[model samples]
Target: MPGSGVSINALPKVSLHDHLDGGLRPATIIELAEAIDLDLPADTENDLADWFTAQATSGSLVDYLKTFDLTVAVMQTHDSLARVAREFVEDLALDGVIYGEIRWAPEQHLTAGLSLDQAVDAVQEGIEAGIDRVAQAGLVIKIGQVITAMRHADRSLEVAELAVRHRDLGVVGFDIAGAEQGFPAADHTEAFDFLARNLFPVTVHAGEADGLDSIRGALFDGRALRLGHGVRLAEDIEIGREDQDNTYVTLGPLAQWVRDREIPLELSPSSNLQTGAIAAWGDDMLDHPFDLLYQLGFRVTVNTDNRLMSGTSLSRELALLTDAFGYDLDDLEALQLNAASSAFLPLEEREELADAIVDGFANA
Candidate 1:
């Protein structure tokens, strides 16, 4: 097992569902918060980090999202946004992520008087700075921005246009995130239609806080190329019979379409458990549908939805899955390939990613 050792951090990987506001370093958050006179729940960096974890683990959507208000409050200015984005990439590269898509909503950042374009430029500046730092340290990594529109908010059309406006700079895809239960993807049909007409790639936050109907809306209304935390798609899978080695299963129409279409599921195992997205299944990682989706040939990709809240990295998430499902080096590589292939990048660039994954995993 020399080449295939289970040190998951050393494996080259791709992250698709990571949030920019959710992955800020604790120390940096304290500094930014202090500068802006923002009151925090904890005094020291470690305590603040622990507070984040505790709140996220409270299993309530309200509690889990409370952590973001703090993260986003400090991120109102261009400098803080740049610094946070810079560190986000640095951290991902240190964890051996070769490619990542960092998503955040610009409408939420305009409180500091920065225009939407200015906020994006600030993040781009930080990302480039972070990429340079990683490169100087002798590791190669690439990152792209996914401009997000809040699901409950009505500014998606504006955000979608912003995403398209910056496609050449750093923005890659469009996404609709936040409060997925009462809000459906169809509410933003105009934005999705605009993106579709303009040929912009989209990934909808579906099948996480909601169920199968939301996923159908994501595909039909949002024209989503991927599902964010789509672990709930497992709700549509019916177990027929099971024996010692063979288990028969059936996919519902929605599940069948998702599987046959091979739409990548950006399943964040830890975040799913933390947010109670998998509560119906159970409270443990063993109860996660990640292995079931993988066994059924779904394009399953592993991710860390919010590194800070979950107290995890991509490496740590993979390690958790490995522990829960007994996954090995090959399994990790397969997930990376799934993510790379499903990236919003151009087909040629995606193929290059595939080749890089092949080369990296070959060493394993």
Candidate 2:
């Protein structure tokens, strides 16, 4: 009973790449839809969940992203946003996430007449309520908001200012999400420069839909401390094999810079597959470059990019990685440690998070 009785749910974890808009509960979506008199793709919760999963498996990032229309449709109101944020944190806590950074584009949620500040405030209120509720239950969890701008939109400079304005309230960092291919980080030069001038931290959505050039823009233009779904950085790696046991791997300048700088890669195994980020490698989880990047000493962290769409929890993602890569608890701990260190919190706060991960994993 020793190992069988052990609960993977009790393990400490960190979530860095989760999207707030993409993690809506199926039940909540149904209720919100009913209140707003909106027709859903499916009437029942289970069917809706399955529909989301299927739609997300389109094997193309743009196609996969279409599933967000229904979700974002329901999340236009301040009340709905608050409720979703609160439930998102509770769900992560239930999944054994001790710390999480939730990212979402504010401009997308303003269709309901709520200002950007109001939207962020509503989410913050929900997050604080969730934190207090979890603390009352004798469980500790911390969450921060990453204000995201839509890369395809032209409001990044305004969004970046909004993030910096709310830094002390609930926003911990800034990000640019949405279509990542053509809307390079360079397009948001003013925004990035403002963030840099204000000493704000950033994590860019690079190396997911595009390749190393996108990543280069994120670093040189956006000054990103982390890369959201930076899985495509593997393309910069060159492998040679004289024999099965003598495989030689070499990193190009871009890959070497990323690895040497220790830029944390928020690798979402299931989401990456669902969105076809790893299609170049293959169509299986085993084909993901996560192991290769980790082996080469890149700061690789596991995440649930879209819990509802991907039908995954952080624990489930970790389990999948463990199954595919033969990772023990030590490897799990290492991933959490990397996330803790890479978080956009203050130096002391990050250190405290690292200590918590170390202590929790030790006891586990």
Candidate 3:
């Protein structure tokens, strides 16, 4: 997998659950921090990157989330948000992501006096700029915005309205993020209802920091179409093993629903390990439930939940998985197909993306 030498980078991919704030370049964070005169956890970019990785490795959901405070602190201004979004798209293109849905909480970006509309517009502008840049370079890429509301905050209804208002411009979906443990999706029932009434596609961050109950709330209450890191849904599986080749498996009600419905789980291998989302399974990539889910016919797609923090790209994550699980190009293509099918875009657009992935991997 390692010696493939850019094969992974050239293979087309679909990104379903990458975060805009969490994917900021470390150097950009330094520059943005300097502009705001904010003190960062590390003085140098290298140290800052290391600090982020360490913080996320704490195995406690709260400690893992603390790293976001620094990233969000510098993203308060319109210029900062625009720059981050632009670079985010460019980074995705470089990682061979043909299409991506970038999710971020607009409510968090309003501290600099920018209205919710202005924040969403700024990101749209950046996304357009990045698309133009890629086109100029003779590479094609597409991106859509997933406007998110912080679940712990009280402004989800307003943010949901913002997302619906900008659907035609660039926004493609709505999500509830932040503190998945205490702030259940039920807490944002108003926002969820607003989104549901508007018929906007919704993907909720569930089963990462919480358990099956949180995931249940996300589906039944939030009406989520896709699950963000629903890795912990593995908790519902009871596996009984014999010495050689004989293993019994039983799925709980929640797991049965997710698998029966083919709900896509955005499985970020490195991020899951760093955040301890897979702690109940094991401490390494081999221990992830991704293979289990895949074998069980659950829709599973690989992702880099945070590129900068995890020091990964979509290509790198795929390569890592290939190395861990002995997956060939066929396996990779199936994952891309899963992501393309689960995208919030129209059916025609999703089909186009799926075709591109097929052609790219066929050539690779």
Candidate 4:
């Protein structure tokens, strides 16, 4: 509804790549930190949010990741985890997200004597509470937890097992996050193999801090059903002009496989720019490979990798794309449909979600 006077926030959307720890409310962080007497870089909520956004936009994935230290520090206990999870759902509901998959590393929430199962249970409790709240507010929203393992850590197999054990509770999928450069998905072979054998869904953090090789490992080693910010896959494409008014494009094997298979690319515009994932293209949104990838038939879905860090929502990301690429309502609907198809849900549920998105967008 571009110029039709409809706000993007009112449209139903699906969020596939949001991070749980990365989407904490700054005010909640302040409150939680006070109970634990945890030191913070800023005391005020606004100031702390500003600090996180500043740190995240430093154009280095390593530096951007450091901001998580503060958010994760406050999420060690059961109550804090549940509170964060609840608020995460509430915030997404406000942003018009009909469905969302919140990913977080259960291994990181173990500093407060929480067992792996205990952490998962706490998050599920929070999620259920949030869902009830949303229903009370006369809105419908669905959430699923995508348990993650730190790529640099050696506990991926255990985390994968944790996800499988909790699959019926609330957990939906598995992911290996953190550094994606040297610690490729190959390092977590046992975990990925186990997930595959169990028929569990997976999405790996690749093509963000690394190139096509990392993406390849994600496919071959991790067997990722989706690529978390697979922006760097564009590196495998070569675009050239064939004439003054014509152009030609060639896709490498990796890019071809991803496109042909319709593997979703969880492209986070602000997060990608902040982490320098699209630095080869440029710093601006227009330089994003999103438009190119979309035009080239890649199943590119919009996401907010870390809402707190990037200061964004799924709606805002879609609006940014429209502004940068002159997209209309149909374009936005296509992106949401991509996300709906990419969700880690049963085929019937995904179809229902897709129908809901279409109906919502049509009414908008």
Candidate 5:
């Protein structure tokens, strides 16, 4: 129980890259689907949960993304979106996350006769309701939305404007997500420029389905403040022969810049394995570059990129990393602090979150 002795859940944590649509609870998906008369691969809650995990880990790129279709189907309405968003917050609180930023594409939810503003309003209502529920339970939690635009689509400027418009309504940031290869952040330069002009924070989905070039584009073209699942940045790091003193490591230009800039890499261990993001290294959690990045002094934060698909949480992600890399409580604490520091909140609020995390870990 050395690792389990200090409950990962008891340590205050920050979630910086969680996906809203990917984090839907299976039971909630079931109820919402039933109400909408949508057919499901599994009817029972347990079976539905297993279906999501199985589909994600099936080794087929097509299968991995199919799970999102189910969750997205049930989220096409105002009531369903609000309900899912509320439960999304509640689940993070239960996982001991003191602060979280939920990311999702508003354009993907517009097929149900909901305007962009309406969808944002609905999710904000759910998020606030969830926060109130957590307070009633003698717990404290805060959540911010990171509105995303689909990289394969042409609505980024529109979505970027939507995010900026709702900044005061719990929207704190902007992002671009979708197939990484062939759809670089450069495609959305205008949107990125607009965001930059307005000083809105942005994170780009890079280094997951592609390599360092995509990450470079995310930073240079998108002006991203953080890299979502930027695990592949390890491609720029060279691991050399080991000597008596230590292992020789070399950083390429991009990796050097990222490290020197202290840009946080939102690494999701289980999701990376399931999606074959770390296949270049190996098909195991131990193959993940998370340990290498952290050990090398790069800003690395643990995440559950998609809880339902990966069957993981912030606590579970830490536990998996611990099992694979032999991380101790101190290592886990450092990861949370990195996430707190990289949050899109104002500097003062980020400092407050960091202090709260430090105190929570000290008490734990």
Candidate 6:
């Protein structure tokens, strides 16, 4: 799918912006919903999967997010969350993801009488079990939790504390997700301050639902090391003229800063299209700013924001980009390298992951 007669799914990849609640298997959701005696949009697994993809592609972020209500509802129990998370890892491993950060809001799962700590522990247990399953199959996969706090909610400080508390267990970083337009990162200043004081890594959901102001808030206010769906950062780039000879381009200060600093842009091709994130330019893959950002030397990393919602995988996202941008093996490897370097891991661990990517690509 990455061209050159090579299968993109066979390459070692890294996933940094996947949401746990958004990637559940349709069969699992059906079984869990039945176990809980909850209603569902569809009866069969195939019908349920089709329902989710259809609802998510409505070209509205709010509408797309509404699909999570069902997934989260069924995942309210400890066993359910663990099962969902375990399946999350198993899916990523099958997609050839060597390292992945699964982000989810623990606060959303407390309705079943589980504490914040317990929620994190259950996810960690599931992740460990998933890792063991992969190893037993003679494959390697590592998973981490990016404990997310709802941006519209006021428990960011508590969520930050939860992330720090579980840092040694399974949590690798902190994130602010959900409703990015009205809820500025400034609203969580106290949480950001605490995280900064503790040297915790942060990735903010900006440039997807909103514009430059949100991205600025994510950086200046939240101290984000990475931008989740930072595709709208393309707004900061000014295109002057195009000719057979060359195209004149100018970068706004914000774009220049992000490019200079090499902050990874978690670009989800399908999710961005489904949620109308790239509607400013057009409604097709060709209109996506991913290629422009990459050509201009921005640290752009491909992602599948929600595999089930978008009906995509990391390999599928890369293949879509390859088709849209005419990328080759080198381009695919570069994307993985960007994701590996941008992961919230220790320097040594990140280097090891990069080496693995290089080896995998070489063998490919």
105-128 per-residue lDDT for model 3 (tens digits): 988887889989998999999999
lDDT of 2 by residue, 1-364 (tens): 1144555678888899999989999999999999999999898999999999999998888998999999999988889999999999999999989999999998999897999999999999999989988888888899999999999989999999999999999999999988888899999999999999999999999888888899999999899999999999999999999897898999999999999989899899998998889999998999999999999999999999999999999989988888898888788889999999998888899899999989887787
Q: Please identify model 5 stretches exceeding 4 Å from their true place.
A: 1-4, 60-62, 242-246
Model 2 scores worst on lDDT over the 10 consecutive residues at 1-10
In candidate 5, the residue pairs with backbone N, CA or C atoms under 3 Å apart (3 or more residues apart, or in different chains) clash, namely none
Candidate 1 lDDT, tens digit per residue, 163-217? Answer: 9999999999999999898999999989999999999999999998889999999
lDDT of 5 by residue, 1-364 (tens): 1254688888899999899999988888888888889999998888988889988996544468777887888898888889889899999999999999999998989888999899998999899989999999988999999999999999999999999999988999999987778999999999999999999999999999899999999999999889999999999999887877777899999999999999989888898899888889999888888899999999999999899999889999888888888888788888999999999999999999999999998888
**Candidate 4 lDDT over residue span 57-146, tens digit each:** 998999999998889999999999999999999999999999999999999999999999999999999999999999999999999999
Candidate 6 on 208-246: residue-level lDDT in tens? 999999999999999999999999999999998687778
Where in model 4 is the C-alpha error above 4 Å?
A: none
TM-score of 2: 0.98
Each prediction's Cα RMSD? 1.5, 1.4, 1.5, 0.8, 1.4, 1.0
Q: Report the alpha-carbon TM-score of model 5 versus the true structure.
A: 0.97
Clash pairs, model 2 backbone: none
The whole-model lDDT of each prediction reads 0.92, 0.92, 0.90, 0.95, 0.91, 0.94
- The per-residue C-alpha lDDT of model 6 at residue 160 equals 100
Error of 3 at 302 (Å): 0.8
Candidate 1 C-alpha RMSD relative to the actual structure: 1.5
Off by over 4 Å in 1: 1-6, 242-246
